[model samples]
Target: MEEEYTLDDPTLLLQAASDFGHHPGVHSDASAKAFLHRFPLPVIINGCKNREVAKGFFMVRGWGKQKGSFSEVGCCVQTEDNRGFGFGEYFLEESRSSREMVMEETGKEFGFWEDLWWGDQPLGTQYPRLFRVVVDKNISISSVLGPSRPFSWNLNFRRNLSDSEIEDLEGLMRSLDDLYLSPSVPDARLWPLSSSGLFSVKSFFLALSQSSGSPQNFPSKFVWNSQVPFKVKSFVWLVAHKKVNTNDMLQVRRPYKALSPDICILCMKHGESADHLFLHCSLTIGLWHRLFQLAKMDWVPPRSIYDMMSIKFKGFDNSKRGIVLWQVANIALIRVVWWERNARIFEDKARNSEFLWDSIVFLASLWAFCSKAFKGIPLNVIQLDWIAVCTP
Candidate 1:
């Protein structure tokens, strides 16, 4: 990608979009003579030949990238400088709407109108800028007359949340099914000694993760499956990817260290990367097969957890199937894996595929019941599921 421009260029900055036309349609001609009508020759090029002339014009005060526009806000002006006086304005007036203008002015907090030199009613003038407002999901903008384009930012909560709003944020977390787990979660104190990640409830949700908008990052592809809701995607990414403190830094809480990091809690032979716990561990693989049979889905053993989630299974759509069965599968898998890990470390419980099998099945049934009962898919579903996951 071209680097984002940090410094400004004088010539390009000086070029206004308002002036490049001759008698009338001349600016449309693209010939050197057309440009000379609006700007002095010296302003463009010292040795003004036709070939060099157009090139020179691009560097002039009102000619280049900032091609003049008559637009007040809505209609688009051609990059070509100088259209008829009313053309771009007519388009703007026709296209612009007051509501859009208001949204841009208020919602995004932008625009420059520090000084107004002069104005006339007939000329009909105002500072042009992108007016954006976040209304539900729709945003509106009014590009005012001239070269500039209007832009708006949709703030999640205006600059800062009010006390009432802050209450709502806290209430939202408490009332809704939990969406995150982190080492620092306040609820960590609630965990029994048997739980492996005995961090606060907040810490469990704050794992380092790729930022939400990264197109290539895994979080981007995390489909809003029936298993997972869109409202909670951000929460999931934080825990799973540990991109808290906004994707640049890792782990919001301290990194989770198993009592012993080297040995797999399930097999006690393998190491614990995501892959080992989710797939290569023999106990986990068996849990996968049994769950697949229970869900009545095809079973292709994943060599790794990433491989498992990465596969394109047939017929996965949310609205239609709510294959909540699929989401249940993921929930069940993660829970079982963590359960097995805790069992080994805290309970000194050894690996038992049979135990893993029974644990996931029972847990899936419990969550499926909760989901159906209007519990609103628990957020700390992992931790909540942990209650039912025994070390044995």
Candidate 2:
């Protein structure tokens, strides 16, 4: 025999509010806010329905300036529209027993964490101007959930929520509810939505640090080529992204470049740049010619750094092996020249063009043998002289 009972009015009301708040398609009006306020759940559910209402609610609840706790979490999440909805769903899906266990284990209520994270000030208020700058095009789950900024997360958003929006935020408290109602308890854990486990200020920082941009423009082959060593590949990745501190880039970024010598260390005449260092430097030019000569190929250097690393061989064989060999040589040349430049700067040592060329050949062949799948290329390239092995 089962107990016969219908769902109570409070349960039905809770379901209605959760459904309304969690669905993005459903517009949140003043009436909805008024209704939710009556119930007064522990969690503020519909705060993120729109920017204005969210800010107003925070200000009214004395959470407007909250810095690092759950309020801070809620504030950050509410900055954008959809994040609030996603967060609410995750919050609602979590069971009360699990939340209690997490609270017990951590010895801090959810509000304590909120205040701890967002502490005494608002992120949007402090960096209102820089908000847009931090958010990448493809917003990920971490971007919404974590309060810490991204690697490129320098404060620079275009604008912040307006005064009218802040003024208008009202009546969001009623929708706040625990993840589950009576009888059905869920497993205990923090950050049920996050696979990494644990949600702390440090984890928030990790999330911001891990936030990355869209991969639409990422050069996959140039950075991830199998023929190059991981170290060399990383170096090239920095070069491609223009993050390497070449003299030309340094001059633009820092005031020290104005006082220091801006001339190329390799050329001693021109300004050092990714382009001149790899392509146009007098010393580097000879190395490129030597590589083409060794491969029994003729070539004219490309103008840009990207083109140099990724140029298609127009009149050459264009075979997979040929392309791989060319890129290997290209990456090797870049690595050795950059290394030579650094050696001159840091160690006060310099190598001649001939030594540099030999180093390129040795490195390219060694990396090819060690890092790549060697099938058709000669085995003697590793066993014997790479110059003799590569050249026909």
Candidate 3:
């Protein structure tokens, strides 16, 4: 006997507007204004308000602005299109988490003195605790210094400074004596990833992608073939990276499941891997041989999909169009084999190697017809003599 019960709706897992509206840290007009108040340099520099400051001096946000009046400086003041000074949208999308942004701002404040060093020797490393006294009191260099030279220090420490602390502070003052604080130009945060030092979403994304330990030997040219359909190209990319859900991949993905017979479905001899399934299997070999025969070329099969995609086939006589046709055929063969394997497993259907070769030629011909080079040419002519039509 089995119990009969209806499963809870899957949509119940998703949050509703009423529920998400109450979630903390949700970006809103008021919250965006608050965030901008914490970092006001962007707001002021973008024609929001006029303020007097030293040229090339970093303007810390909330310096003289009243509390809770971020809008006064046009921080989150919305335009007619509801885009508030552009900072609100940037804060919501481009900027990191609020906590991270706050920590970055705090670090910049504490490390302000280090940036003033114009000498070859690192001042911050030599006198790390030079600004520690003022940092403890949440004091900024701008707050302490007088408007005119000789600048006066108004640092207030939590407790009486020790002899070593006093020595470090004196050294810091001597270091700052030669540094000039500009009175007109506001210090802007430069993006280090790009040459222009301007923040861009593309640069940020590229930085993240590079930092994520991506494979060095990615088959970019092979996987991104413009002749094939986007879906086929994506499938080829997965196969090239050995990320396709072959039997071995299935085993890894569902480790707890009792998936047995992890062998190449096409040959049923060796273990199923991206290399074996698409490149080394007997059925796959036959398809490759057929492709090579149709192209009227002598070739040796590569070890893996990556190797296959990486190698440039010779005998094309430096013909760019011929190379493109060869590439399209290779990609189509891979797609056709995978399709047949899936059909056999899921639909209990099978196709012979010759039939699969025909399918590959048909698929490749269809993609070729889509190209301007093959336009106005009959489909049967292209399919029958792909190499002849593409050759110079």
Candidate 4:
């Protein structure tokens, strides 16, 4: 017998009233004005005063044994809505003995945990959830008692009850399927904001989601690409390094100079392309090569930082190597890259391959050794660029 029941009465209270020439009802005009007492009353009493549901319930004056308990006067109260549903009357009129029988028989046959973190997640539809900014409240439950005893539970839709259980011990076969409920919104808070990285410039950048396309470049959590978040911190540093990379040279005679025309100030041969100056160009490649040699590693200049981390090393375990390299390189590369950027911008000249190589080597060695010794991770020069930790 699979069934669910609701106690048909919506009010959950019984109502009764009598005619109004009321006798022992509340009627007082005086308030709690501190001063003299035992004075003649200014106002008189009548039938019943209008009342709303509120908390100033009563006042107790006579101390215990000051008089007798029975002498403690209680002014009678009445409601115009006739909702004086007395608790004493309810039990005598509708004694729910039926529930006792059901509970005694159903015993421990039906049970489940309260799953607070139930909801439809927006990403990776099959997975539970990923971006849980708040605390997660979820529960795990075992199979229900089946085909042996009849038991049932229901969530009142109006009451907004969730994490409920239902069981049908008689002629039941299938296990109750796990489900997630929709979440509710809380009021917009005027609460004090904590300085827990809340007012970051990263957040300021994130606010400009639309409107400006070219100048606006920050991550958005709402319409997020899975690849974006992992690259965010590095990307932010990379974006800031632009002034460091180009320095005062941003006022180029033209934004669109043919690669064959304007010569690269570094290589002294081919023209400068945003792509070429940062990559493929001989001057930068030489710097990278010398840096790699100092670190006693073979030279392999990736087209971009994105490709840099993508290149795999063969000497170590695959998964561990990538993660270790990334962890180490993430900060070290950003710092060094910004340093290179500053040298070009402020110094008005790029360092020679040897000098650049020495800097890279120093950074790489210091970070790599620290990561291995203290952090138990490895980082390489290439892995330090603006790249993601995960592909998906």
Candidate 5:
């Protein structure tokens, strides 16, 4: 393999797509260009020029290394820029309906304007300027327009002029008359770098990404699987990815350790951490026991949230559906435990283990019944089954 590759190189890009888990035969020239266009040009050009630096930067941001794995790096860039690859634009139908529904309720302009320029229009104030131009009346004008000060300065004053000086100024303004008091409307055809008609490389890439309308990142089967409620799945994703601010995490991140409580709010026996609060705390252990009994399985809680989420119930009742139930139950336990911990700390209230377990049972049943994964299963049936399993 070459040490570097460019977007212009289709074969290498196709290989990169394959490395990113895109099927080999599915990638065509058009598709590859579509994918490559989703990234900033520097991300393509400069990244191709310096492979190690690009790879290192991406790895530090939680992306896995692959030959063509810059897709995720592009996602990180999009996230940092707060300009998703038109996820908002791609779902226009959904957004339009939502926007219309809100309009129906409020009966006013219901959406924000993206390009609204605040304050005065500056239309009349806009004008072209001429500055220290050494023009010789004797010679033909080489170029009348040169670097200039603001038009305000041009209008304000002029020195006592020789007849030739008056002629020169008149010639200069008359030569460039079309530019005087021109409305500075934004150009729609070109990138908004300057009036020089050049591409703003950054804006060009951003516009390219928006025009392609590809997803900011690949679909995550792990997060979007049918086993859990959408809200529960989102919560687990945040926890497993270490995105939430727990006491332990806050202490490590911030210089002031005094800001975060040192002890676990649930147990008050050990330092608080996501793993400890959700999985290992004595208060959470009893809840876990009830969860295991509900599944009728023996499970040693994993040391981390990631592993706990990936745990599959292997008891006698372990069917595909049964596995989903336990997984949903496990994630629900995390959510409830976290909620209870916050309640104790913030609200000065707490629930007992039995109450927590009952919440989990109701939550798990509701999620399963409502989700497409368990569409064939009735709500009452799921509720009864949840109760029967946990009744030991």
Candidate 6:
């Protein structure tokens, strides 16, 4: 005898149908009948078999109501039978009914004249209530023309208009004379943030980020240096943005933890901060002075890491290979300073100013050698005479 299977198990039903080359031979339950009725053989076969099923089972069942005309808020989808109202007329009627319902429910009237007016000039100082009352909310804009020629507003107010309101109404009509309506095209919402006028999450996020204030300039040249390692670049970027986990940042991030004597590890006289440690500390100043003296260039101290990275070198040519060495040297100095700071805090180890400056020169020479611009150059040559290597 053949194995018994119920229609409730769709897998077995499909298997039986495939075996018998027809409908499955199984007892139907209420759920199975409802499922079969809701989704016919064509739908099930098309969904499961990718329309590769035999043509014998591709039957269509028509038992429900047919859609005559489908209408959305801004656009319309019509069927073969266009035996209904146009989209404009339907939208106007629905808008008027919704306005009336809102007014009745909340005792407040809402106006959309700002949305409708697409003129080149502004509709200044006109009352929204006057626009709502004067214009027929149930009619299209093309139907608002006067009996006379030359395009006038044939307004019909529900309430008596005062002299001031009449003057404002006349100004509004003058503004509307420049407006033209295209009834054939469907309405569409455009995103002003993007060039293609399509909505995107990136554009929306940028808009929200800039809404509070002007966006700060990013130090791309400093943070995206190809000569430096990725972790060193990331650390420099954090220092530039004041996001490094110094004692001052820790105070704000963890207020409950008692971090005593929040002073700079490099210069214990001042409090520790991203700016203080990287730019203003006495030890950091000494290191910068040493690098400048080695380069034989006079420089003014910058107030912050961002200012230091953003400032352009006045006398140097940017396209020359020497500029690459200079940039790598600057980035390496920042990384070495951060390393020294962490060493003092975490390892209880310290390096004097002379040792730190030597480390900076060594690391800068090593990183500069790895760059394609400085490839095949002797490492000792770069370490001994870096100023010559950085000269155009």
Encode model 5's per-residue lDDT on 1-392: one tens digit a residue: 24333446643553564345344555332343345445554333222334345445445423333212232112222222222121111112212221111111111111111111111211111111223332221111112222232332123223565676566557645544444222232111111223432333354445545654543442244456747657767877778766677887887798665864589888888988777887789988888887677556777777876666564446325555565666667677788898898899899998888888888878878876776657777877887776443222
Stretches of candidate 1 exceeding 4 Å from the true structure: 1-261, 295-304, 315-322, 372-392
The local distance difference test score of model 1 is 0.38
Give the Cα lDDT of each candidate.
Answer: 0.38, 0.51, 0.58, 0.31, 0.50, 0.56
Which of 5 and 6 is ahead in TM-score? 6
Q: Model 2, range 231-320, lDDT digits (tens) per residue?
A: 878889888767787987777787653735777888799988888888889999988777677656788888767776665553124554
lDDT of 6 by residue, 313-362 (tens): 53223555567777877887788888999999899999998898888888
lDDT, model 3, position 29: 38
TM-score, one value per model = 0.33, 0.47, 0.55, 0.29, 0.44, 0.52
RMSD of each: 26.3, 17.8, 14.2, 24.7, 21.6, 15.9
Stretches of model 6 off by over 4 angstroms after superposition? 1-190, 201-216, 314-319
| Winning model by TM-score | 3
Candidate 1, residue 307: the lDDT equals 51
Model 6: what TM-score?
A: 0.52
**Candidate 3 worst ten-residue window by lDDT:** 98-107
After superposition, candidate 2 runs with Cα above 4 Å error = 1-218, 256-259, 314-316, 375-392
* True lDDT of residue 127, candidate 3: 61
What does candidate 4's lDDT look like per residue over 1-392, in tens digits? 22111223212211101111112452211212111112221111222233333111212211111111111011222334322211111111122211111011222211122211112211112122221211222211122222233423221122322232122211112332333221232111010112331122233334433335433333222112211233544453454334323422444544564333245566667655444555556766665554344334675566654344335433112344334433343334344444565566458767766666556545544544453332432445333431232221
Give the C-alpha lDDT of model 2: 0.51
Judge candidate 6 at residue 63 and give its lDDT: 12
Q: What's the C-alpha lDDT at position 50 in model 6?
A: 21
Span of ten consecutive residues with least summed lDDT in model 4: 63-72
